[model samples]
Target: MKILQDFELLFQQELHKLYDNDEIKAIFLVVIAEKLGLNTANYQLSKKDPVDDKNSAEILSILRDLKKHKPIQYILNKADFYGEVFQVNESVLIPRQETEELVDLIIKNHKFSQNLNIIDIGTGSGCIPITLSKHLTNARVTTIDISKEAIKTAQENANILKTAVQFINADIFEWEYIFSNQHYHIIVSNPPYITPGEKKYMNENVLAYEPELALFIEESTPLIFYDVISSFALKHLAPDGDLYFEINQYLGAEMKDLMIKKGFEQVKLIKDINGADRIIHAKKAW
Candidate 1:
């Protein structure tokens, strides 16, 4: 029970029923790396070393939460996103790999531009805007969120990353009142696109542990966030600017059609690594 190897065995014994072998190992390794600062090589080298009573207590506490299907990131209060770690809580959704692709796409498309102005809607953990600010030093970034708690957590992340992303507490639906005349060269968002009906297909850990406010939309309005943000972009984006979104896989064609109907000069639907229709880029005409 005191040895690091014993803790690894404990994870397997406890979580084997809940997770597959690879998932169990990945979760155990992440917990060990963060909680004990041991990488896989070092973990293997020191697996038999006795852990202190305090560390053992902490591991047990985390294991208890894992039993309840709590996300490891929330249990540790941090998440890995776009090559950096961000603070996370139930108030905000954990960053995802699809979002990283969205950020990478923006960086690739805008890296050469000078003095870019970009804004991100729905700033959960501030990952999108903050990562953009870090990579695109010439850009001024603004991010908005409806939840004050999400803003607070995201602000902490921005501060930690030392990225100058302006965090605003506002609803995207009311952005016109807040930023009537201001224009951005790039507008991006990874807003809530999960329909309530789709919840049945998602894993229990996500459905039970993650924040519903940042995940689900009414089935009646599957495009609520996308509908509002993209429309707002048509008004607030500068001439020749671009709008980007991480979209629902099922609604890719519909989203592309919506962007085209909104009169974007060019609309490109891009797939994620998993080949899901995951991102959209809509360019405004000059």
Candidate 2:
């Protein structure tokens, strides 16, 4: 393992125990490229590049953590969302590609206009609002999270992304009381929609490392956030305001019906790249 190329075989062997051969290779390649400051193309060209004793030990240590099911994003403390990098830790859920689809959906459907107000509920990592602020330049964006730590992390990410997103540290359930005057032209959330019963189906890394508060809900009321937020929109959203959600894959029809019952119009459920129901788009038809 003294040579960088020499570690490849051993790393793949270790990762193969937990991941498919393709994924193991992909992960190893990414880690090596990042650690060695080589692009994938260059790394493939320099497979024989040597690793010093210190660097070899560091690589092995990281591999050990990976073997224990630590998420690679947490290992690097960064995730790419919507063509931008967001800082993430265990306090917040790592921004996923599906969530990027959620963001893209909003960006595609809504044209950013002057004074457009947007608020994101449960702003984990602030990825949604921050990205919206970055691209929706004239939109005044604010994001709320129940966890102060998550708010702080979101603030840091906002700063890094050079986006002016107001980070509010209050439970969304209490938002009506705390910021009753606040209303929005757009409201979005990628809230905790996973049911407690579904924990058995989650990945080892997600269950072991990601914050549970940002992941799960009571099995009896898996759509608690959606119910509350969509209802809130009935009173708070401006005329023709849009409401977006990254929903549980299992709840598309339920979400559409919920929004419609709450009086939202044009309620649409969208599938992710995998064709699983993952996003819902609806509007207040004032």
Candidate with best lDDT: 1
Task: Point out where model 2 deviates above 4 Å.
Answer: none
Instruction: Residues 101-198, candidate 1: write the lDDT tens digits.
Output: 99999999888887889999989898999999999857899999999999999999988988888889987776688888799999998999999889
* Clash count, candidate 1: 0
Check candidate 1 and list the clashing pairs.
none
Worst 10 residues of 1 by lDDT: 171-180
Q: Kindly provide the TM-score of model 1 when superposed on the true structure, using C-alpha atoms.
A: 0.96
Off by over 4 Å in 1: none
Give each model's clash number.
0, 1
lDDT of 2 by residue, 1-286 (tens): 3666778788778877678888877778778867787777887778887887877887888898999999888998888889888889999999988999998988877754667899899999998998888877588998899999899999998888788888889887777886678788899999999998888888899999999999999999888999999888888898888899999999988988888888888988899999999999888877
Q: TM-score, each model?
A: 0.96, 0.96
lDDT of 2 at 82: 90
Which pairs of residues have clashing backbones in candidate 2? Answer: 4-51
